[model samples]
Target: MPLIEIKHEGLHKYRVIKGNDQYVVEQKARVQLQQWDEMWNKKQEAERKKIEREKAAIEKVQKKAMAEQQTQDAIDELEMIDNTLIYTLEIDDRIDWDSLKDLSDFKDPKPIAPNKPLYSSEPQKESYKPKYKLWDKILPSIKQKKIDESMKVYEEALDIWKNETEKINSKYEKEVDEFKERLKNWEEEKESFEREQKEKNDAIEKRKEQYLSGESESIIDYCDMVLSNSNYPDYFPQEFDIDYNSQNKTLIVEYILPDISDLPTLKGVKYIATKDEYKESYLSETVVKKMYDKLLYDITLRTIHELYEADAISAIDSIVFNGWVNTLNKATGKKQDICILSIQTNKEEFLEINLKLVDSKSCFKNFKGIGSSKLFSLTPIAPILKINREDSRFVDAYNVTGKVDEDTNLAAMDWQDFEHLIRELFEKEFNTSGGEVKITRASKDGGVDAVAFDPDPIRGGKIVIQAKRYTNVVGVSAVRDLYGTVMNEGATKGILVSTADFGPDAYNFAKDKPLTLLNGNNLLHLLHKHGHKAKIDLKEAKLIMKEK
Candidate 1:
């Protein structure tokens, strides 16, 4: 009898029993293997958990470091903004006209060649070799049968190969045609691109010529391009309107300044690893206010310097920069736009100052720029001069004062004549200080009845005038419209003149706004002061209207 041999892991054992039964031994080995497997699995699970905890700890540390880096970056950004004027001194403010052109040349797309099928040779038939054996001479018919079968199979394979080759050739022809079509489309696209590029280059050249010719509109456009190309932080509004006065070669810029609230209040961030939380610290209100004031001063001086330096064509002799802010009025709880700072300086005078060495606010004051001591207060200040927008809506005005007398009730006058009469009165009012007033087209003036161009640099600018020849009292709606028009037109002030008195709400609405509400009495006083006499008899005019 053979001896029973049992192997268990590294141990070998031979056992002799009454019967050679391996079932019991196999069962014992299986139980031992399961126990070892359980132990190994537990060990692997413990190691995996340890790795996960370590990974999580590392990720938390990385996150805390990243948060700290972001806080520092924000602080650095604020510091950069504080030195805006100084940093800009190193930059070249002039516009390189050539750089504005599309300098990238057209590149022909890579041609895709037709995928020709690989040349496949026709299948050749193999020659049949007769099998030789001792009995082959006696069995020639069997060998012949085998040779015929081989020839038939070879013929069938040759026919199949011919068909496949034909299909491949046909596909190759179609691919060639498609390639030609694609090439034609590419050619047309290239032609169109070249034409467009040529047209664009021509337009740029024309604009350059116009800008160099000292054309007022073209100069304004060039200045706008120069300003638009400037790089600023994302928080900056960077919105501005530019106007050029060719007569005086002065460029007027109405720039939108960022409010104090627009800046980042966060000073730093700290991470608590135990709590797994980040705590942020913020700048105090006093520091924020100081930053706001310094930033405004920097912007004012920086803008003036940029325009002046970029005036390579000598198109700009002087610059009038008005810094406006759009912010919520805490008192009224509504949006308000007000000019916070204004500076008018010639290029010669402004360029002489070394911006890197001087303090921003002090330099601004040295130039006699007007602003409140604390710019964060949002105090409204008058500009030295404002951009006079050329409005095509203004039509020539006829003398309405020449046709009016004391008895000529303004309330009874024609609505169109009343509008012209208001223009004449204002013309007379501003004429003493070299101001001119023009009446806009009737019904098409876009809510503007008249516009006063007052040349008084200190207090004069574009004044929007709306004339309401109402026999009844004027409501606040008209006053609100005047305010909106002033903002839309970028005017320094708005004057609402009515034949009758304004309601108390109308006056209240105009309060704290750059609006002047002239009731019947005020209108009469203005008329008398301008050496013109007119009467605003609303009650008499109402009775006369009933008769009609």
Candidate 2:
């Protein structure tokens, strides 16, 4: 029935006796309590063990659930990619510049009065009047004396209250003045902001009017805004350059596309219970390639459609989209950008088709887009037309070839001298075809080291050249900048020559983009070809620079 019963005495001990055996009570009670304590300890230990087991089981289940959630997320991402074009169709591509204006009024400061001091209200004059009783009449002298004392005390109290009231009024007046100053400052700031807002709105209106009038630069700027406002997945690169031709009302867009390697590869994540680890599955190569091709096609068509739909002013009749990708070249182990697709579609033809019902790849084919059938392979193709180059930043150039010799180390030459030397050599090379090279002014080059105009119709046009005289290797950034210059200048080609050498990435980026990169060896060969020789010693150049 009961294991043990305990009795309490004073603080000295608890009588944890088991049974009433009066002869051997002490020894039998001790033994029974010892057994009972051991049994209680075992029960507590069993409870702790059960809790640990449940905790471990719950953790395992949570891990598996997390893995399942990850798998579902990956699947959702893939679905979004598959419907990229379809999703974009629902968005209104036009920009509402009015809604973007900041018209919120400034909040005015509320007037806060000072807390008034608890000053006693003016004492009533009649309350201090002395009472005249019958006994006071019998003692007229005493009563008159009392009345005089009371009047003196009342005058003294009134004087003290007047002083306290003055101090409180002074404090209240000071607080009011301080609040007035703060309000004045706030009003000044609000006025200045209102003026700025008015100017901003005026500028926006002017730009809108220019865009409506079909101004060349204004049209390009508006198109840029349209593209910037378009939403895309975070994985996509939103970098692009635009050029508009007013005569035919055509816009050319050079957009940087994300590489296939940059896309998410995990098809699903699975939790392996036996190993207690997560395993990820990936899409097959063939499936990825097919999806990549379709995506490229979707992007090509979607870009053109958006621009056409957003052209509310009817200034643009057609758009040309050239999709370019920056990636590492496996063959050369260098980074380069290749134009994977180019498509031109007019407003009339593009608006006639129901985009939601058409397959992206088939629609692109119907419009005769330029690209390889298998786009994942990163094949290069020529654009139907190039942006026109009409830069006016070029100034009258000076000559520097009269100062060069066989002993001249180009790596140690002045930067300005190096640019002129490059210009002279190119001049000699292009002279055979009646082309001339001109070096831009040193202070106003605007990212253009030199400019060359070739007279040959088939192989010649405005070519932009940049010179880099570096003791270290030229990286991909310089090469990428050259490509941007080529697009901005509207040149037929771009050339980058360095005195030291180029990094692997620089070489990679120059591929297929009408760009030329000449390393130290190539520079030496070009000089030798022109019956002149120059050394490119980077180590000596560094030493000279350090000494200077």
Candidate 3:
């Protein structure tokens, strides 16, 4: 319809179509305007949705921090409970209340008074509902005004829409900028995480090779890492220390024993619905001790088992285990770390025993490795082999500063590096042996340092090499131990290389044995014969070492 000025519905002027064809022009213009309005509204709605999603993303990141804090708090509570031994306990033997009246410390038990609840009922959850818009009434009214060309109320309505739309667009633009910043941060964080992961994997691979070739400090650090990640029962603390001796190829494990005094004796408490009270049930002290003893024994076995199962442990030929408890001695009124149990078992011997079928009480006895009789009694026992801190693998050296110069001579290189250098020298010498020779981890393993299998078909057998960096004359004791190791391992021949000359007694002992002793001169010659330059000067080595 065509607009014509006329009084209608309290308006001084209203739009009307005079003829049939004139109304078509007005309707077409109305359609075009309506399309423009609808397109703009769609654009605004799309941006509103985008803004909402970004807000949700920000909220999720905030919630993650809160969740992590909650998890850490729960773990702390469990640790405290474990240390205090407040787990459920059972009491079978009742104490007579009247008999303790004469004692100054005697007192009757009192029921605990209940305190207020931590909080009111948890926050209620409500379903979400979208807002209702009056677009039906408002849209039609605005279209009629625009079509009539009133320009007064029509322009006012447009101004309001434009202003509101602009406000929303401004808000959405700000949100988008914030979202973009967050996205950049997330990308940077991800890249950094990937870099860190790559570094960690590289370190693991390098350490794996070092560990397999008789560098076991990596194994100790690996075990600690695994245990640190392990989820122990709430309240239980896992603490341990380890060292390796390459000579006999033995791992020395010093583990902290858990306090069992607070172990729960009660099986459970039954809530009497009729009386509105709980009936406590407790186990006898003897029963509690027996349970704790079994638990302690199980823990000891599990620790050793986890280490043995690790693929990284290549050279641990045997283990010397010790569990100590830190407590105050009533008699001395001094804190002491009392070694409750100590056992030594070779890898060959330990692998033959089955843990499932063996009782914890009889495990030590069956292995013939127990050195102490008072596990539960807490009697202290001296460790047969003490940990050599100097033996710590360079790769896992913690709290160490100032890099050690790798190019330095034998006197300056640490024991692990010295052993590694020797392995490299020998590996080069036996490169044509047709098989890879591996060094056993630095541990007390009789006297074998590295093992090589010479496959000449006729001379195909195990060959052992011992690297002795001693500045003094190689003694008969070392040669004898090497010979013993060769016999124990059933090797065809053994070689012992030293940085110093062997005594007459060492040569006498090796002359009849299936062993060859290489002095400092011979070792250098062999290394040089294999296209490697190396020299051992005992006097110079001693002077350099003593400078420390």
> Which number leads on lDDT?
1
The digit string of per-residue lDDT tens for model 2 on 1-548 reads 22344532322235544445554666666675666677667877888999998987887899899999999999998888888788778888887878766677877754565675677788777888888889888998989987998888788889888888888888878887897887778777787667656645665676677777777767777777888787777878767768888788889998878789877767998888778899999999888888888888877887888888888889888888999998899899987878988888888988999988898888988888888888898998888876654446555655666677777889999888888889989999999987878777665443888889885646676688999988999998888778766655556789999997889867855665688999899999998898887788899999999999
Q: Report, for all candidates in order, the number of backbone clashes.
A: 0, 4, 32
Per-residue lDDT, model 2, residue 545, is 91
Best by TM-score: 2
The Cα local distance difference test for each model comes to 0.81, 0.80, 0.59
> What residue pairs are clashing in model 1?
none
Model 2 TM-score, 2 decimals:
0.68
Task: TM-score each candidate.
Answer: 0.58, 0.68, 0.39
Q: Root-mean-square deviation of each candidate, in angstroms?
A: 17.8, 13.7, 32.3
Tell me the tens digit of each residue's lDDT in model 1 across 410-437.
Answer: 8999888889888888887898887889
Off by over 4 Å in 2: 1-30, 107-120, 134-144, 392-548
Residue pairs of candidate 2 with colliding backbone atoms: 335-508, 335-509, 336-508, 336-509
TM-score of 3: 0.39
* Candidate 1 global lDDT: 0.81
Identify the runs in model 3 with alpha carbons over 4 angstroms from their true place: 1-193, 212-214, 229-231, 273-275, 311-313, 371-374, 390-548
| Residue 102 lDDT, candidate 2, scale 0-100 | 64
| Worst ten in a row by lDDT for model 3 | 86-95
